[model samples]
Target chain A: MDKTVNQKAWFLVLPVFLVVAFSAVLPLMTVVNYSMQDTFGNNQFFWNGVGWFKELLDPSTDLGGRFLASLGRNLFFSLVILAIEVPLGIVVALSMPRQGWTVAACLVILALPLLIPWNVVGTIWQIFGRPDIGLLGYVLNHIGIDYNYVSNEIDAWVTVIVMDVWHWTSLVALLCYAGLKSIPEAYYQAAQIDGASRWAVFKAIQLPKMNRVLLIAVLLRFMDSFMIYTEPFVVTGGGPGNSTTFVSIELVKIALGQFDLGKAAALSLVYNLIILIVCWIFYTVMTNASAERKPQEGAA
Target chain B: MARIDLVDLAHSYGGNDAPQDSFALKPVTMTWRQGGAYALLGPSGCGKTTLLNVISGIITPSRGKILFDGEDITPLSTQKRNIAQVFQFPVIYDTMTVGQNLAFPLKNRGVPKAEIDKRVAEIGRLLDLEPYLNRKATRLTADAKQKISLGRGLVRSDVAAVLFDEPLTVIDPELKWQLRSKLKALHRELDLTMIYVTHDQTEALTFADTVVVMHDGRVVQSGTPAELFDKPAHTFVGYFIGSPGMNIIPAEVRGREAKVGDHVIALNRSYDKLPDGAKIEIGVRPEFVEVVAPAPGLLSAKIERVDDLGRIRFARARLGDAKLAARAPAGFTSPDGTAGLKFDPSHVHVYADSLLVEGAA
Candidate 1:
């Protein structure tokens, strides 16, 4: 058999490369350029030579302080979101209707929040948590609890977290539901024959079967919550006094609000790198752990 | 171990108002003796699995009572019934080691740790799974995982019965024989009432002492291997149990005689007073019918083809408009594509409406 040395295959890949360069590489290059340079008004630019990166890293500097605070806030928010969503998602998935028309109905309801645009979700929650007008706000206020998001830091954080949870927990639930559905009916029958209790079935069968999807859910939820901006931005506007401000919101504030292009570009690069590193770690650790049980998890 | 009795047991997935044909399992009354290895033999959709599930209490019958050693267990849940069922597909806790998978049932039932360990070890050795006991079950091949599933079922010593639902479907062809023999040995060592459900005739025949043949949601015959081969109670069983099956042809019957078209064949015993307007058919296995030179007073047939199966040979021949297979003697040849069929009268059976008719001696 003669092996054909084909250079024509490279031409087929050309279109994809051009599309990626236009859609992603070009914009990222611009950010990289801006990160290394300072920009003056009148569309003028000059080399800054890592000055913005230095300022961004130093906690004593204004840019660095804001960046660290928001990074900590983002990490904390992601942790809390994951802690609440994964278990809650599994529980919700377990309770989902196994069959009939009701299954479609329940799936639709679970998917409703995920289908909404992020900005729309933010806007909805912003109005919904208002002290005077919104249903949730009005009800909470009528119950005699002191709850005002605008004036109180904890209230603002709570509202933003709840809003994010309400917006994204469906994503986790839907993923887990798909995982649970992939399990064959025979597993349940076997579990019953084994004299397994509800919890034992979950621990032994359901949870193990859901392993791959839960890893996916955790990674997706972690990355998404870490980069969350629109909902919190609309609901709290980074107040009560920056308490609800996350990394993405702070980056937007620097670039658009303050016109600190150098600082913002540097922050953007760092933020992207952080998400990348965390996701890489997650993928590596998870794939390695599941590799011992490779063939079964593919059913997911 | 316990004897299981299905007293008028029936099931229909479509509810009570559904028509008779819609019943997944037609009304069945049977008793399975304790410690007997039984095989529920049938093709797919023949209600073998449904019957097995009913026995295991995984499915509750729509009507009638199930008895475990004379105690009604019709309404009992599978977990409470103390019945172990291995499914068609191997179901193992993927995260657990093979030993842990075996121990899961005992652990779930709050068995003492020492007892669980001893049983797990015993089952491991029985299935030759000792080396793989500490290995994750998910890493094993389909055959080994099936062993783990079987081990889990056998781990519980107090279970009344063990039901296997086509458990070898995923096993490799070469390994099937080994696993099957292992299961037979386990049944003997454990002495549990084991009911194996399989669509494969070879698997069913080799695995069970008594094979229960089912067809179209009914138990056609439940008898020993020899009985099933020699006297299948239904035409379906006769056709289903053997390779190339029994040759059945429409015939006109009278006392001590049956006619295939104008060709008369002698019956050892008289099948007189057969039901009126019933479909009368004569069934005889190829092993019982001999293909020979065309002769007088014998059914004449045109030899269509010869199938030499190494050990035995069968001649496919046409009698009038119906085709039949009959045993061809060693070094046999038909010079003019014509042959005569000689049936062993005692081995021949008469069927009416697909059910076998017992002839009067």
Candidate 2:
């Protein structure tokens, strides 16, 4: 084999670099710039030099308290979403019809919520949770249960969680379904021949085969649920005394509603850093666990 | 551990009302004796896998019963029948260690811990898997994984029969022979009935004591390797079992003579009552016919080329517009175009409509 160093190959990467610089890097640099400066009226700016970061982290000031509370709410919501959706999604995927026209029908129905625009989903849920006009709220109230998302904090939280589950559990179910479908028929036959019970087969074959896809599902649900905004915003408006306010909603309120550019920029940067760190930890832990028993060349 | 019998077994995936030609497996009635090693050899889609699956109780035949040592097991589930099967590709639980994968079947059966450990150790030692006993099964190469699949099948001592469906297909070419011989040795030590299904003749001939050749959803022949070479029961068996397959040329027969296009040949015995208007043909292997100098009282053929295959040489010749192969002796020179061909009378067999014809003395 000939060993040659080709420097011209670097030219081929120029287009992607230019695209990323224009779309992602340049805007991110602007955010970074704003996070370190305090803006005055008429577009005048003064350097703050990490003062906003210190304030956001203090937890005693108003900006720090809001950031910490919203971050806590975001983490709790993500944990609850994972706990309910992952198992429910796997059960739905398992119970789905394996063959026939019913499979197509079920897939189409499962894909319905994912295709709707996010704001539209929020609007639909907002109207659907109104006790005066919506069926769900009207039925719950008529059945002797007090249910109103607009004026009650607990109800607002419940409405947001249930709405999120209804909207996104399908994604997890579809990913697990794809994982299940890729298993060959021979595995099932071999299991039957080995006298393995249904539960045994599930444990030994189906679950192991689904590990990679389940990791993807968990990461996606975690990140998406962490940064959720539109649906809860439309339904509760971070409302009933800020009970359902997640980190994205708080960031929007700080940056747009009060025009606190420096604080909002600092909060957004921290939020991005948290997500990146969490995802990295997730990927590293999972890959290391899967690779613990390393493969080597065989004697034969 | 038990003899298996297929009584009037037949299956048509299309349905019972489907025509005979549509049957995936035609009615097959054969007895596989206890502790006998058998190979089901055929080309792709010849129903070899279907037959093996039927015997293993994976597929319920549309008609007929499967018997295990005189007990009817036709309606039994694969687990209840106590059969084991290894598939073409390895099927191992990725999360389990090598030892755990081998012990899974026993554990599922609720075997005692002491017994499970004993059987797992026995199988591990047999397959040389003891070194990697604690490693995850998924971390091994494909051949090692296949060995794990085989180990799982062999771990259970009371299985009726162990069925292999081309288990060597995923193995490397060099490792195939080693694994194949290992399986043969296991059969010897265990004295268990094993049915190996493969499309490769080499694998079949080297592994089994008796090879059952199938064609077009029917078992064409069942015999030892020597028997299959000396006498093929059907034209397909003749054409399918050899490197350069048997030469089957059309001929006319009467009394003790067989007539090619222009040359008359003598038969060892009289095949006078060959089927009426049936297609008569002569079948002989390349090893039986010798290429010689053109001489009197011998059939003359045009020798096109001679192929030296390390151990033996074969001559491809044209006999009156029909192609045939004959052995070329060492230092045998080809004269301009024609050569004398001498066929051993006892080695030649007559066939009627692709089926062998038994001649009277």
lDDT of 2 by residue, A139-239 (tens): 89999999999899888888888888899999999999999999999999999998999999989998988877898999999999998988888888898
Q: Candidate 1 - CAPRI tier?
A: medium
What local lDDT does model 2 show for residue A229?
A: 89
Q: Per-residue lDDT tens digits of candidate 1, residues A98-159?
A: 89999999989988998999889988988887879988888899999888999899888888
Clashes of each: 0, 0
lDDT of 2 by residue, B1-361 (tens): 8999899999989877899999999999999989989999999999999998888778888899999999999999888887889999889888899999999999999999999999999999999999999987877888899889989989998887889999999788999989999999989998999999999999999999999999989999999999998999999999899978999989998988889877888889899798898999999998999999999989999998999998999999998778999999999988597899998998889999999999999
Model 2's alpha-carbon lDDT is 0.91
TM-score of each: 0.95, 0.94
TM-score of predicted structure 1? 0.95
Q: List residue ranges in candidate 2 displaced over 4 A.
A: A1-22, A286-300
Task: List TM-scores of chain B, every candidate.
Answer: 0.97, 0.98
C-alpha lDDT of residue B245 in model 2: 92
